[model samples]
Target chain A: MNNHVILDVQNLKKYFQVGKNLTLKAVDDVSFQLHEGETLGLVGESGCGKTTCGRTCLGLYSRTDGKVLYKGQDVHLMKGAEKFAFKKEAQMIFQDPYASLNPRMTVSDIVAEGIDIHKLAANKKERDEKIFHYLNLVGLNKEHANRFVHEFSGGQRQRIGIARALAVEPKFMVLDEPISALDVSIQAQIVNLLIKLQKEMGLTYLFVAHDLSMVKHISDRVAVMYLGSMVEITTSEELYENPLHPYTKALLSAIPIPDPDVELQREQTRIKLEGDVPSPINPAPGCRFKGRCKYAKAICSEQTPQLKDMGNGHCVACHLYNQ
Target chain B: MSKLLEVKNLRVSYHTYAGEVQSVRGVTFDVEEGEAIAIVGESGCGKSVTAKSIMGLIKTPPGEIKAGSEILYRGENILNYDKKQMSHYRGGESAIIFQDALAALNPTMTVGKQIVENLMMHRKTIMVDGKEVKLTKRLAMQEAVKMLKMVGIPNAEQRAKQYPHEYSGGMRQRAMIAIAFACQPKLLIADEPTTALDVTIQAQIMDLIKDLQKQLNTSVILITHDLGVVANVAKRIVVMYSGNIVERGNARDIFYHPKHPYTCALLEAVPRLDLKNKQELASIEGTPPDLLAPPKGCPFSTRCKYCMEICCEQAPAATDFGDGHEAACWLHHPLAPKDDVPFKTEVRHE
Candidate 1:
């Protein structure tokens, strides 16, 4: 990996044996790279393996196959002290702050938990200073250090989560729908805080969310996932302006514009998919979206499409652009 | 156009051990017949409380409806209605769709059974050609299946037998819509129905609600924090802030050209897909004031970017801006002294 590429995931596959004969392919052959100081947005519906992929990348869930390359080395191959060091370099900010944090611990102890585990702090005074520093970094005051998680609001609790993630001073962070559980007003504050911290710390982020508007705002590049595969990946502006994949178009069109006059004139006709998303346990041989895809053809059902570059770093996994 | 529901100076408070926490403060808005009105605001803005107030669903003890509260459903004071009268109104003339599908639905009961129970309760008898006929449980079940089909649930008959947990988030929402419309209520109050759902599912649910509203001619009160969801579905918009109707106007008027500062701040706060360049997403600075002892003047004075001394000193009364557009802010109030600072629309790009 080059200096531009902070973390590179290649053909990552994670599967689980659900029963006697069935194998659930959670993340199948997923490949993406997070560039230094850039936010890469990962967007998909629920049960699409986006969460699983994030956890697998973080080493929280052991990968069934493939490699996670961080800073030019295979993450799984690292051993002993090197593997422990890698843990400090890559951290995650989870979706639900209420569930992610330890309810029993105070705010300071929660932020200091990682520091204590890694033995980063020199002494008790240094650890206390570090904890206060991180809490302030995420816009929390020193007084919040003594407060319990329950005392804080949803937004403040999320801020604490962010502060905990930042305490380790990780170069790359995986934000798993951080703002999905937050209120709209509070969401803006958190998103803005994340952007500020990213610039200040020169940090790289893999921001995963289902909100398109928010994804567009924060992401330098975006990777759109469906079922268990990545359908498209491109720069945020390019993806929004000149989408190549049919699914991308459908997703973009689905976003409700906040104006009634425009909405009235605009055709709100959704490409109504007949059935719910199929089970990931035993996915079909063809495109995962074949059943719901309006442009699906006979070939779509017979063969799985591969992600092919369409020039200017825009990649799509649909046969329609495969000429 | 005749008003279907009119909420006048509705105040709801939660009697916590700490104190009486006022949730909804002197909120007033009217929903016309066959019109879809969206109440858009952040959490704790009294959006849900307003909806609960209209439905007569506010739980007492912890939650208390203040003395001045007046909810007029078809020009009748619903707050004064007895239990029997209210029962006739609840789920019969008005129905509510809550946010959480799992919590809203009974896990043990199948979706079909729930819909059938509601249909039987609200519409036990139907009129056909001036003759009334009673509906059996079997007929109610069949009608429930049909209702599911109407909400665009494929394989409705088969899926209806499955419990709520068996259905996907999108399907459960559709089932909820089916139950809500099973009664054929004149007014449907959907409280953040799509907020808990994903974007794609959110779209589907919004479309479903719109389609059903058109078909049934049911006036809808869409309660949501998402401004995007409100833009398309609602004919009119009511913006609530700290339990007050800060702004009310046509959806287009509010989105395109907002008069109130709070409304403008809210619009700016939302992250838009079309925006290019990276700029800080706008956020309202302070937390909402404690409702028990709300600020004397404008509730939003502390957070308002263009706040003046008058904003903190005296409460601003609702000022009509003609064309049925109204806003409660010192900026628009004529008697209030004008500030030197002019309203600025500095477009921040990222």
Candidate 2:
């Protein structure tokens, strides 16, 4: 419940051209705000443009429309020292730890890349000390500084990636599926480390992931995306307990709980979405989830539904609710 | 219930340059007829190796099944089967569906042709109008379309004519399921079948498999790392850790009253949606033991919180808690020292 806004995105859009004429609308008219010292989880299945939305918010990809404001300054329009300052203030932790870090570089060098680029340390000693400090902060020790990325396990390599992200001293971080590639036993370690670091450093995070259960665990608030559109946004507790959107209900029901008793008995209540996600390319001029929604009506296919606030900061984008 | 498959004292090792990696050591479990048994474990825990060994798909040179391993299918030991006998037993009696449908399916061949090929290899005749008719290639293709339709793929006839890449991830998985059930294999091995799919699509695929399994009475060996996935589908749960079975029990028993420290750690590790508060997840402290140089004692002894003095010296034997629920942990021993803190039974809320 942080009242201060760290980053504000409005009508953000990112489109990729496929061939001569085909355009894939990766992120379309998505808007959200990240509060300081809070984690906003963006949850959606594969190809729903959650990753694209995260990238566009950080100016990693040029937005085709809308604006991304970082501390009331247009992120896309920044230049020179301001842009560099923004880069240092905002960082990203990639999904694939294996590919994100340079295999040839030592772990120290990998962590120190952001430090050296930002010139945070004065000399070689200061740089090495800073690198070692970050490595230790992420549960790694001094012995792992000199080893190459390949020498480390998936969890360790992910630690190195986190060290690299935190080395820049970013107030805001974009964690794109940080734990998806990790093993089950190791995923909790990374999540706990992130939560601990966030509490200690007062860092704000935009955690984009498809794992809804884990997302709800770390995020203070959650946003649901469907086909490059924001379908729902609310507090993590409210979103899970009283989901208003049909897609959110279906998604929550689809997730198999580890408890066999509840899952077996609740089988009849589980909503199995009949078809796959609709194509984002040349999308229909209507609610993106209309194709799979059971309550879709005539108006659902004619006009795109806009996200409307339904009191207490809960928002949903569906014709049945909005109309 | 009759036993569909029985594995006993199975051990598997990989020939690495460093040494022989004991991927699976002394694993034993049995699958009853039409029962769904889930083999759950993390990476390098030898769950996949156990499934592969059961399917006879392990390559001999680099990967070897130890001499005493016994894989009995329908009262016959499949481990001793020759190549011809294994081939006949594999396609005709059992089949497997992989995680990555695109990678498992042939790219060049049509989906129909692939299913038809599998049918031709297994079936020679079909009942038509109460009379036995010789099954031909065309008839198999027709049956292939029907199989695709059975799995809920719309426009099955046209979709069958398309290549694997033409279908989406969920459709491809459905196609894979169709091919697996084409022969109506009495035993089906689904190795992380829904791991790569989305949750909604994952739900759909799981529902399809369960429906078909009931219709065909196919005993399934669902191998996966996610404990949540196996809850609804599998009647029995087998928890493995570092090439060993740490716990085996009914699904409800495993979820409600997990005895093994590793199982307790795992149950606590998974983040539940029904949790009211955003508390920290309890992760196991260390990584899995090295297969090449396995620990002298229990595999999970390094990370276990309830590890006792004797646990570091030798592996614990299985302790039965009645009704086929068993756990291999020193905490269950009668003479073991009681700790001040008690184990929590209900990790999740209703």
lDDT of 2 at B216: 93
Model 2 lDDT per residue over A243-295, tens place: 99999999999999999888977798888789889788988798899888999
Residue clash pairs of candidate 2:
none
DockQ of 2: 0.84
Off by over 4 Å in 1: A1-3, A268-274, B127-132, B334-350
- Accuracy of chain B in candidate 2 (TM-score): 0.96
lDDT for each of the candidates? Answer: 0.87, 0.91
Worst 10 residues of 1 chain B by lDDT: B341-350
lDDT, candidate 1, equals 0.87
Top candidate, metric TM-score? 2
Candidate 1's residue-wise lDDT over B63-115, tens digit each?
99999878999999999999889988998899999999889999999999999
Candidate 1, after superposition: displacement of residue B164 in Å? 1.4
Candidate 2: docking tier: high
Residue-wise C-alpha lDDT for candidate 1, range A264-307, written one tens digit per residue:
75564544444566899888898998888889999999999999
